[model samples]
Target: MSEHPIPDAPQRRTPGDEFVQALARGLEVITSFDAEHATMTLSDVSKRTGLSRATCRRLLLTLVELGYVRTDGKAFTLTPQVLKLGTAYLAGLGLPQVAHPHLEKLSAALGESTSCAVLDGTDIVYVARCSTRRLMTVGITVGTRFPAHATSMGRVLLAAERDLALPETLPALTAHTVTDPDVLRAELVQVREQGYAVVTQELELGLRSIAVPVRTSDGKIPAAINVSLPMNSPLDPLDRLDQVQATARAIAEDLDHLH
Candidate 1:
């Protein structure tokens, strides 16, 4: 979870005849829990998921019975069993299996943390990572997520997915974060032209990162890779962009072979 509040779940584009609203609402209830809201009361969940108290209770109780959530009579928290859902998703993609070795090599070469992530809604979700040390206040690992507008990898993904609308006024994660949509859009255009992005002290005060997009052989931009370092590090992120780009290309090549 982040310091920012979770946004409401997105509505379906065209929930047609076979659409199951109950299942969708149930998933929303489960996703409402994050690191910041790890332990939420029934009212808290209802508010976060935008579900009625009755609906929230029923879904929470169902999750609890299914071993996905646990309750202490008053508050609720996700259980380890919930990891199964994320695990199934990752296993289906086989992304970690394909990228972990390359990320490890890249991290070893750069002596920095390297990660692979995909855009989901307005955020980036880490699918694979190789960390050299703890850099941010929160631990960066598989399944970690960050707002798209304020991160290097997020910018790369957003630049690649041009049709996804950028919010008019993005949240300022730090003093250096780009909040104006037009300014951010221009930066993304530059990123698109240059084929990479570098973010400095945006997501956090002491963090800087550089990222490149990873594309498949058929020309699909599926994910992005990044290397994170201290904001005041001696090495310039641009000086090492070539290496990061090479790693991204290698990962993409491997993924192409997989397909």
Candidate 2:
């Protein structure tokens, strides 16, 4: 008998090999500084990303050279120039011009807050929001981010993200947040099966919301629409859920037509 050799499997692409991947990591380093960690030493960045201090310093220097970051004697912080990167992405999306008015209409009709969100890693970012009043406490605004496992918009977006790799155990963000990965996976499954997601007081106390996918004519979900209400609001959850789902579907249909 002749000897045979086994076939080799294809090698996977590493983060370092992809074009623009390094730029993304650098941008992440810039974004890692926020109000709480507005100014951080090189050691702080190393601790946050678990990268070596040398690596963090190199990236930080690159970012500073690009005008996306500024540094003092011992600490570094993001500069306003960093907004341009995010602004360029938002400009390319072209969603705000089309969806902002619809969000406003939804909020006006329902007397609640409405928003459009897209997935960002393990979080959902509000790209557009319409506030009905000034009484809410979540302090949500455009560019705000919230954990996907704890919000209706996050679950709806996750459900639409069939390619996303979900873990077996989820990290908790709050007391009511779902920590069991299985439960979150089940919730995502339910969202897909039901075509919408309803979350109550998971991200914060008295915060309730419902979300539905915003799909294109080709049935590709690029974002999600959601209505946020207070837990103690007199409005019934089922009623709000129906309204939000219907409005979101209508918006999706309108977008499909435009596309």
Instruction: Pick the TM-score winner.
Output: 1
Show model 1 residue runs off by greater than 4 Å: 1-4, 8-16
- Per-residue lDDT, model 1, residue 4, is 46
Evaluate residue 16 in candidate 2 and report its C-alpha lDDT on the 0 to 100 scale: 58
TM-score of each prediction: 0.91, 0.79
Per-residue lDDT of model 2, residues 1-259, tens digit only: 1011111222224655446856655755765665557799998877765556887898999888988888885999888887787888887786766678888888998888899998888788888999876544445677777778888889998888777787777756557878887778888999999888888877777777888888777878878988888877887756777667666677777776666
Residues forming the 10-long window of minimal summed lDDT in candidate 1? 1-10
Q: TM-score of predicted model 2?
A: 0.79
Model 1 lDDT tens row, 28-143: 89888887788999999988987789999999999999999999999999999989988998998878889999999999998999999998988899999998998887887788
